[model samples]
Target: MIYWSANSTNSNQQSLSGSNPKKKVHSGNANNELEWRDLEDYPLNLSQQEVMIEEGKAGSSWGKSEINSGYNSLLSRTLQVKGSKVNCFFDTEAPKILVVDDHAASRMTAAALLAMEGYEVIEADSGAAAVVLVTQKHPDLILLDVMMPGMDGFEVCHLLKQDEHTRLIPVIFITALNDRRSRIRGIEVGADDFLTKPFDRVELAARVKSLVRQKRLNEDLDHAEQVLFSIARAIESRDPNTGDHCERLVTLGQNFGEYLNLSRSQLRDLMWGGYLHDIGKVGIPDAVLLKNEQLTLEDWEMMQQHVLIGEKICQPLRSMRGVIPIIRHHHERWNGSGYPDGLKSNEIPFLAQVFQLIDIYDALTSERPYKRAFSPAEALSVMWEETQAGWRNPELMQRFTDFIHTYNLK
Candidate 1:
């Protein structure tokens, strides 16, 4: 039948549907299906939603008993679809989806439906709780109720999208209202999809499956980028002079981005840029690469080519698109003085700007064999001199210095 179910006896068995309610429909008993009346006329809309959400309403009597039986179309009549192809994103790990609804009865119903569809369901009763849960638990998907009391689904989605930690999580708004304005509002607030009240059980299950699959694919992409970064960092470590350069610069670039209040995507790109900015140096010859002395003009040009090399190396990786700018443009000065392209002022990528400043700062403060390291304050002063000499952005440097002092970053 159309019911999605997994046998409870086999925990290792991965199935698209949960076994309990789905089992009732598929157990071949026919008695459970017989017990379920046709719900074709059930008005799945806002009033029914208010009844479930608000106490002392006309349809408040709708309970879990009704929800469990609401959608069990015959398998023979179910819509046929091709099975998903297994790829890097397809894995045995079951995705966790957070279901947020102010009404417990309604929430339990949705959770049961999703759980039957082979997803691990995490439940939250309110919008505020969902926000906190999203920050701490980082669920792969959120099915949020639009009718919460204090912070509604739209507000919760907005808040989560605004935070770097939770921004990547996909949001699907579940609402009783099917109006054009409500749908538009949900979209404006960053919702990926919408599930109207009294939704078709099959449609609901399909939507959940689609989003969870997409999220898993995204996770695999993230994993790929992580692997690429590891390889790049390993290459960087070949030079004895690196000494925590990538990690420390990542911290500083992230801090500066935070101080500037950049968006989550901007901040995340900076972090990636920090790790892979020197990735192309892996291609440079050691003679010029490890040299501590001032570079001759030829050596300098060869060294600068590392930027172009780094960009080319990462160009093929679809997942590393965000990181390429930092890798290639981190050396570009504000006044068109730095290599490799000498992109001036705002022409430089914003993320590259943040990374470049910290890249220089970290080098200045880190102790080297030929020269003593500058203290944090001294490092800032030296960097300020670069700003004055048109080697860096004067305004951005001023803000970064302010952030350093305000946060007491040493």
Candidate 2:
């Protein structure tokens, strides 16, 4: 249960729950002696009779459904009291919104509105404060003000969007500036929505709800991708000889792609391919997968089907489109002697070719069940021989050799 004191001046008072609240007030509002109690005191055992009263108004109740909705919101967010200093422990499961405005009245109004809707609202007085809060709080949505002293809304939004960690958090510019140029600027800086000042409460709620829903869906997709990666790692764990193989390939493949000036999309594909290229091996029987002796022709044929199986496994994810080629063609040879498709030189995907070199280089330099680890020079020599025999792209092979030598890569 949450307790609120309306205009009571007792600074040392305890909450109704019998806990002495911490008296650490926010620096901006030193006159307001609001104490924040321990968040663990927040009860999951909510009662129907519980009522949340307005700060200064008495004899008004928001109904049991609203109370229940607020409780549900508390499950995933830190409970913040309106018109007071907020310094509470975070409950990460809640949907949180950050309201940023230099004006105290406007900021409090927005916070109160969002908080009333059963969404956790955090406040920032300025653009700098907003950026700091975003990094620390990781709010699901941001209602940013356009005009500010330093680091305005556009700058803050641009900074947040540029970062990989914070980019997905939706931002809506709430400002008095409703001109076309400002809207275009907001779009360029990655603001998801715009709300003009004296904005309608209904419109604000609708836009916030839509963007938050979209953000959650994107998060779900990210979770699904992580699950696929976990499965790939699990499959790799089954082969003792391939320990850390995927990790090495991902690092090396990314570095080589960067050296080759590959686009961000291609680089992303190379990284995914490193983990998922051999994911089809999950479909192979353990007996064949762990075999120590040379495989019979039929066993070899079955082992070769892993690439196709892996491609099919990952085909459902639209985001994996760029990566699919790398997964399917990494084993193909320049001389058209490869399995599955048997595609000749230039027919193989370029990203796959880049990944194959990293894979082969790692294989040669790392110890295997059958062979000892070779020196970097020795590995490059072996790669050179393969390139000469038409098993690899000669131009790319020469570039790889030069890159290895220049970087002194092991």
Clash count in backbone of candidate 2: 2
Models 1 onward score TM values of 0.59, 0.73
Q: How much is 30 displaced in model 2, in angstroms?
A: 15
lDDT, candidate 2, 113-149, per-residue tens: 5554546677776787777778777889999988888
Per-residue error for 214 in candidate 1, Å, reads 2.7
Report residue 329 deviation for candidate 2 (angstroms): 1.1
Q: lDDT (CA) for every model shown?
A: 0.69, 0.74
Q: Which candidate leads in TM-score?
A: 2
Tell me the tens digit of each residue's lDDT in model 1 across 139-185.
88898888788888889999988886677788888876556777889
